[model samples]
Target: MSPASDPNARSLVQAGFSSDPPVSNPVALRAYRLARLRAELRARDYAGLLVTDPINIRYATGTSNMQVWALHNAVRYAFVPTEGPVVLFDFHGGLHLSAGIETVAEVRPALSWFYFIAGAQAPERAALWAREIADLLRAEGGGNRRLAVDKCEPLGVDALRREGVEIRDGQEVCERARAIKSPDEVIAMRRSVAVAEEGMAKMQAVLTPGMTENELWSHLHQVNIARGGEWIETRLLASGRRSNPWFQECSDKPIAAGELVSFDTDLIGPDGLCADISRSFLCGQVTATVEQKRLYGLAREQIEANIALLRPGLRFAELAERSWRLPETCRPNRYSVIAHGVGLCDEYPHCGYVEDNDRGGGYDGVFSAGMTICMESYIGEEGGDEGVKLEEQLLITETGVERLSRFPYEEVLMPSRWL
Candidate 1:
């Protein structure tokens, strides 16, 4: 039986979420996203954008096919002319994928010149690929040769340049366009968050002593795929000592009772939105350790303090200055960024810490309403036994911020839950 239909799965389901909710208004969502990308292109005076990144393609054309495979192999792409139609060059035999997407004006078989596909004739194949793109730009651009490209191989860039097509960074255009989400996009994100939380609950329910870290992490992937969600971006669940020096992917070590278990759900859920929530839970049925509570409490404090700073028009630097200061013991292993934007995946406008600025790890930007940000915190002293990670997905609004992720923290670990 499907997880949604299974009795045990039903019992673990969160109170407010639906396993398969009614489909959202795709028409409005697609229209809003396409318009946003076009506006960004127009603002930069680019003739068009060559969207090879699968995430950007989904944003522009609303066509998702083999997204995980396409991430490493650029087998499909889309082109959005600044003021014209969107043309999708899909993977082999994938024409039907975008048939119902109103924003996609045309679909064609993609030409891949990557080494694996073209072998010794890669150069020749790249030229052929460049020729088609140049012709499309000339026909739609009205003498404008400036084209923004999100990503491409050096051979492809050279080939396009040979065709007199000027290439600029299209990632900026895509990122800026994707920053301020439309109403329908927010609706889609809400669904993604709910699905992720449900998976989290399942993981917690089955979590027990002697369960390998991999076994616990697999529940998340199983729930996601079973519920029509996509992939988990990272294997970040760790128990006990492994949790201290963060960024360690899960392993085979058996979790012990009362030990701290930390996980980051870089989980891509429904509609390709990420429910990037993190939490540390006490393993097995035992009263939490004082040390565990201390670490978890600090992480929660950091997340809450940072999340409270989110508001429209707040500068990135000012946020770094005002963000909660990690104590000296925990400072060395702090999370790389205080927060980051989240949508189809972990996105742009990363909020960096003050220390990052000294080493050129920071940039200046301003928060805007309609942008969804993930507040992140990781607190573990350099030589500590276990670490705690806590994050919240939030939506920046006209007035302040709204917490998009509703997964509750560990009552044993948290001194007091934040309302």
Candidate 2:
């Protein structure tokens, strides 16, 4: 059946809210993000941020070229002070790559020790990089003698320490900055959700028995790329027995008729926001078994109940306390986390089970306005090799939350007893 003709699909589409004109405005989006970061740094008394994490660098400077390469080799980095210029230490000789990015003040070579160490002569380059960073920190007002480095090589950190700079964990600053979503960030995320749901709709339209899990998985990548998304972070698509306990990466196994298929979209879209969503599907025209229906229903119950309880000012600890308890049969294989904050990727404020949260950092903080949260649940019977996984992305507002995911659930898999 065509997606539009399916009642479940129609209902989901109708319930999703989108604006008349697209909410993506690149200029405004970048400004909002940088402003938020600066605010966070100011609040934390950080002199300047030395961001080397590819994702964190992209967050600060808006340049994503050679991202994966920078992860292994610290070739690219960004330094932004609370008040002054934004600098891009461009590696791979890609200085021109940051040409028109408004937030960037200047681009310079990121000649790290790693860049020269293969030929030896490492200390020379490390000193140069350290001197450059020391100067940047001094300019940002070295009263604190502190700089936050998100991710960096040991050579670079040692060099900075020798220069008398106290290095702090920059990821903490970046996470606190990104914990809340600006209006434009929310829009970019919503746009990503729309693109992913379109991919889901396409996959649902043509699902059939005998289709390989790889084939089903390709549909999402193809659709997401065509819609301008970047990449899928994980191989989270599986079918039949593979879908059971979850986290089985997509394989060459062929799907059998009347079996469950589950997938998680760890998709990083064009706007650079990650759309981390999951849904379970029952293969074509098959009647779901009683066990299948029960598992799916329980996951839905858990998700819906938690979503209802979410509101601004609700304590994360209280929410964890109130989370649905998994039945004894399902507790052994229950997913570790109930929810986590989502932004550039699976970020801070991970809300674990009461037992897990009670350890020390129990209840990170109160849910505040403008935070984006992903509620997650996996329901698999301990001994059974089949299960269901459900997740939804939400934007917390002054009053309550808005569902950013609009993909329809599998009606056939849902228990009929549920209204």
Q: In TM-score terms, which candidate is top?
A: 1
lDDT per residue (tens digit) for residues 225-245 in model 1: 877789999999999999999
Q: lDDT of each prediction vs. the true structure?
A: 0.88, 0.82
Error of 2 at 340 (Å): 0.9
Question: Model 1: what TM-score?
Answer: 0.96
**Model 1: runs farther than 4 Å from truth?**
1-22, 416-419
Q: Write the per-residue lDDT of candidate 2 for residues 329-364, one digit (tens) a residue.
A: 987788878888998888877888877666653455
- lDDT: worst 10-residue window of model 2: 12-21
Q: After superposition, how far is residue 104 of candidate 2 from its true place, in Å?
A: 0.6
Best by lDDT: 1
